[model samples]
Target: MKQRAQGSAGAGTPPGDARVPAQPRPADAPDGFRERDTAVPAARAARGEHTHSERPIPEPRPAVQRSSVRGQILDALRTALVTGELKPGEVYSGPVLGDRFGVSATPVREAMQQLALEGAVEVVPNRGFRVVERGARELAELAEVRALIEVPVMLRLARTVPGERWTELRPLAEETVRAAGTGCPATYAESDRAFHRALLALSGNEQLVGIAADLHRRSQWPPVRRGRAYLVADAAEHMALLDALISGDVDGVRGLVSQHFAGAG
Candidate 1:
């Protein structure tokens, strides 16, 4: 045993105890680390995904939100529309909807008009527009029409689009599943609509995009277990489409999409 460092020894008797001094950390050692050895590849691997050579520092992403009163109103109305809270061919009065929102008729009227324009509601003679009533036949027609106009385009675009681009839609697809499982008709409906919209959006046809929106509006029905069924199948369908697209097999993608519409009928 060696003598300890001199300090408050006047008050103590022990002088033979050796001072256990901490070794100084190397300059390259980050906090919580002891040392860095550049001589071995394993040491470099232990540091991180990159060596002392090169690495990518990811840029921070900006927060996204639904902003603007009109946008918010549209969102709320879309929720109502999808939830089947608004029935087909049923009229929603400006004042009634306004009261439901605890707001004035101005916003409700605006929302109603927008929905009507989207074909979610139809104008009646000497009366307000009814949320467009879709019969089984109408739904079948819509499913078929969409498969016709959108499927080929989706197939083509899917090939050109990278897996990463498709990945951006994965969250929306997952949300559709959650919405269906939880029986959240409103959320389920919006996310369901988004799933298709995202697929069509891959084509970059704004006019065709408008047609898709109209079809969705015309496709609405009362909340039913079938809606959930449709959502689940459609979610899986989206993944299948992506898979075929990634593989660069357009014909296979088209056939699957066509089969889906056949099932829709």
Candidate 2:
């Protein structure tokens, strides 16, 4: 006839033929070739029960987010200390601050521990943490120590760092002036330290920059009870010092540095 539909018997059954039954795959089949358990969902559906795939996925836990929240709390606490919102010597409980910040007490407690390490606050046993009450004498002493460390290094840098380099730092000095205008002691203190730190960095001494920064931070804790006028004046002094350094006026730099620290005390 027509060659008996050529090789049909050798190919077993043709596509969609009902004569052949399916065979199970070999156990050594690769994982990618394995079949999924499609019957489970079908069996559950036949029993009028929900399928496993229909179950909701769980939301991830928030443990990873705690560190970032703790850091924000620490910064806020430091700002409160600098702005006098957290009065010196006053004890503040973690739960109270947590309620105010819209978070749990754990992050607040962790932040307070960091502040304690920075000497901005002290632990008060079961009470919580107390803002460290730095007095005039201690503030003066901190300022004096800062002056001793920064002044000589600045003088040396003034003699060597190029005019263009000092000019480039003008923006930082201007930032201090802008910060002072905010009337927030914390803002001004941060900008003030930034300018000083940048100037000290030109000395190429990482250790000196670190030590001076530490002293500067301690001095700003419960920042001096000076008026906005004092802040503006201090900011202007930064610009004046920059001017002296740019013009290579060693004596002028020395005088400005001395006067700056003197008022700080």
Candidate 3:
């Protein structure tokens, strides 16, 4: 038998020895990844979406008397989640979100804690948080809850509030329908939220308004796409509810709200 080469593999010396030299990485390898990171901003510029450094980055605005950076981050996160930018069931870290918001992880974490309380996300120990998935069943349950709360309030308002007050809100309600008619989801969502908020504001209970607003925002999770005809039908329903309130038909208002919730689900 031929003798093994000297120093190649003495007994007990493993093949592919630990002392083997590492091959040089290619020029396009991840070793120089930061240089390639600029491509994203360049592409955004091409598409007319200016990069952060291109535009003036303003300092965060003051909230009430003090600067609440955590609140701002929470609001931003909520917007992102509602718009489907932060997809349901996908995990996101504080550092990653902090980088996106141009803030620190501390505020991002604080905001995430609030989101956990709202049932918008679930925290994963040692990992991060993920947006909660809301299925059709969950949405239907929310609609039911909304009907239970809103129908009674609307009934009272119809009986007590003057008819002219509802008529005055006609323009705003119509604007919401117009927004839906335009087929812009964001516009319709905001206008729809505004309409509900305005209606609830008449209650003169800030706490009630806040709770209803939270439910309204939550119900919008996983937005469903309906045809223009559907939107028109929904708008008509809103108008009918207003008419019932104007006519002081408490029974009619209740019936209309029930029908609206049924149709919505």
Predicted model with the maximum TM-score: 2
lDDT, each prediction: 0.68, 0.88, 0.78
Model 1 vs truth, CA RMSD: 16.2
lDDT score of residue 193 within candidate 1: 76
Each model's total of backbone clashes: 1, 0, 0
Off by over 4 Å in 2: 1-64
Candidate that scores best on lDDT = 2
Candidate 3 per-residue lDDT over residues 54-173, each given as its tens digit: 868676555431338888898788778756788998999999999999887988998999989888999999889988998889989998888888878877788889989888888778
- TM-score result, candidate 2: 0.75
Candidate 3 weakest lDDT stretch, 10 residues: 15-24
The residue-by-residue lDDT of candidate 2 on 1-111, one tens digit each, is: 456665566467544432322335557777765233444445455556688677675755676589889999988998898889999989999999999999999999999
lDDT of 1 by residue, 1-265 (tens): 1345444453364434333344456677776864233334344454454665656766544212222445677778777776767776678777787778776666777776777777677766666668766667777887788777877787778568877787777777677667767656676667767877887888778889888867765565544346556767766776676667657677877787887677754
Name the lDDT value of residue 15 in candidate 2.
46
| Residue 66 alpha-carbon offset, candidate 3, angstroms | 8.6
